[model samples]
Target: MTHIQIGCNLSYTVTQTTSFLFNIAAARTLQQTIGEETLQLNPAIHFETFTLGTEGIQVYRIVAEPCELQLQYHAQVELYPDRYDTAEIIETDFQHLPYEVLPYLNPSRYCESDRLAHFATRLFGNIPHGYSRVTEICDWINANLDYQAGSSGESTSACDVLIQRVGVCRDYAHLAIALCRALCIPARYISGYALGLQPPDFHGFFEAYLGSRWYLFDATRMAPVEGFVRIGIGRDAADASFATIIGTAALTTMSVWAQ
Candidate 1:
């Protein structure tokens, strides 16, 4: 069993009535045990809590007036990663894949698998299929793309990242997910607090459905996959954004930690 402690703090200034949705809680799963979770609000505004998908991606919604809005969250949990043998993880044909995995093989807002089909095939088609093919895709991405902070915008997509060859962690993940899907490997985006990530902060990664289970892969390779604590999962970043403000709000301070 692995124990982890994580915390998130944010300070915002609101001009008028603003609504905010937060997805900064540690996901509770059979593999992870959540303990001592806490949330603090400066003005103590009432909030409703809900979860998305079967994994219970926690979301908290609240509305407050013009004031210094401060929110802090802390949690302790344990993560247990499943181990699989490489030789046993054969690529399952489309006919055998589960219904949920089918959607990930299609295109999405940030991961345009359809548009990159030609390119992904021409470059990676010759490689042996299964985990080897997926690894090649990740290797190609790491070698070609330059990891530059603040290089990509919210509107950037997988094709854009391929052309520019530079992006943050999310961009790397988007490109990887697109290529995996083009090869008929079901893949999805994931967000988490990387335990050993330097310049510590929330991180983005991808998982490919291999054999009969989903395996994690990080294109950035900045943190050990086993150390990642999942926060959200979706086709791309659009579904996993940490925060969404409906009205006017200026973020004055933000901090994240994993220990």
Candidate 2:
């Protein structure tokens, strides 16, 4: 098992009553466990904690009046992800897919599989199927796309990234997810804390369901898969943003770390 210490600090200037929904906690999954952890707010305020579906994604909701808000979170996580051999991990047939896994095959907001269907099949159509194909998808994305910080915005989709050929980690995952879905593989988005990430921020990765399980992949190749501590899982980045604010607030500073 790999043990990791992860945390983030967010400072915001609230000019009016603001409601913040934060998904910054380490997720507790079958392969991941959380040890001692804490989430604190300066001038401690009442907050609601909730879990989303079966992913074990924990979210914190807080309402704050005009003030300098400081939010801090820290955690100890142990990861023991399942290991599989590339040749042994074969793709599952559509008719045999689990009920819950069906949603991932369809197009989502950022991962528009429908639009990229022809392009994906044309480029990766001849590649051998299964785990290796998925790996190649990530490799192709890493080689083709330029990783520029301000190249993409919240509205950027997989198709957008493909055309521009420039994006951050999130865009890499989106395009990979879209390509996988177009090739009939069930893929989903993941937000997590990664070890060895150059800038040390929350990382974007993806998972493709194969051989009766979901295998993680990082198109950016910034960190090892086992070092990733999942924070949230969703159809796309839209559903797994670290912070979702619904009022007047401006983020003054932010810092994230994982070791």
Candidate 3:
């Protein structure tokens, strides 16, 4: 087993200064098992509450606030532990919890679930009921999608990327999730920080389940390697958003940097 230190820094460059509602600041770690808590070192900088969810995972949620919105998160995990490697980790069944995720997984008219299924079938065909199929899906996504930033944003959907054939990490993750769900595979979106050598220090990723075990996959980074740090998980970006507010704010200029 190898122990590693992972850190994620996220910042938002606002075009203007305005009051913004922020959430997802709450940070929690998940252990190898659902019942245990993964060790977390540094606590959140500015947060409203820190609590454990029903699944026994740590969570951080922020409330309405105003600022330049520069946030940094750091955590350490034993990567590729003797008990857990990429193959071993991803080969297990995903923990099924559709009851907890269905409401959030519902698609809108613009991105209907049925439409997504048809689109994904063009590439993945009928979703295979095995790990090999899942791996194939991942490999296919990596092979087909080009990893470029600023191609798409928060509202972009899988179909949009399918047509354009270009997108950012979030777009790739959304595309992957849509494809998995279309196959009746329960999948979820993950929002976290990825260690990069450049700015926008954090990136997005996704996870899917085959049966009971949840396997982590990063369509943005392609795979979790040395510098990946997790922040949050939900059905999609809508559920995993870092900040949201009912009121309006003019975002003037925002900047994010990480290394």
Candidate 4:
């Protein structure tokens, strides 16, 4: 088991009454256990913590008026991820896929799998099936795309990253997910804290449904897959965004760490 300590501090300037929905807490799963954690808000505002969907994703909701909102979160997690032999992990047939895994095969806000179908087939059609094929997809992305920190924006989609060939960690995952889905593979986005990430911060990775389960992959190749601590899982980045503000607010500072 790997023990990791993760946390983050965020400062926001609220101009008006704002509702902040934060998905920064470590997810509750049998694979990982939270040892000690704390969530604090300056001024001691009222906030509620709740779970979302079947992933046991934890979300923090806070309503703050015009003020300097400071949020702090810290946690110690023990990861016990499932281990599988790559060579033996075969792809699951569409007709046999579970109901919960079907949605990941379709297109979403950031992943335009429908439009990239032909391109994906042409690029990956000749590759052997199963885990190796997915690895090649990630390898292709890591080799071709330039990992520039601010090369893309929130509005950027998988197609945009494909054309520009430049993106950050999330963009890499978005493109990989789109391509995998286009190839009839069930893939999904994952938001988490990654150890060994340069200039450490929250990281974006993905999982491809293979065999009878999902296996994690990182197209960015920026961090060790075993060191990942999942926070949220969804069809795309939209569903797993770290922060969503309902009113006017500007993020002034953010510091994240995972060790």
lDDT of 1 by residue, 1-259 (tens): 7899998899999999999999899887777778899999998999989988898689899898999999999999898977767766778899999998899998999999999999999999889888878888989999999999899999999999999999999999999999999999999999989988888888999999988888889988899888889999999999899998999999999999998
Least well predicted 10-residue stretch by lDDT in candidate 2? 81-90
- Residue-level lDDT of model 2, residues 72-143, one tens digit each, is 999999889777678988889999999999999999999999999999999999998899999999999999
Residue range 1-259, candidate 3, lDDT tens digits: 3343444344544344334344333244443212222222222334444544553234444433444455544445443412234343332323455466554345542234567776667767654555555667777777788777787866688788877888877777777777777766667776654545355544667776744556667765543434454556666777656556444444344343323
Per-residue lDDT value at 254 in model 2 = 93
| Positional deviation of residue 230's Cα in model 4 after best superposition, in angstroms | 0.7
Q: Which runs in model 4 stand beyond 4 Å of their true positions?
A: none
Of 3 and 4, the candidate ahead on lDDT is 4
User: How good is model 4 by TM-score?
Assistant: 0.98
Candidate 1 least-lDDT 10 residues: 81-90
Candidate numbers, best lDDT first, in rank order: 4, 2, 1, 3
RMSD of 1: 1.0
Score every model by TM-score: 0.97, 0.98, 0.68, 0.98
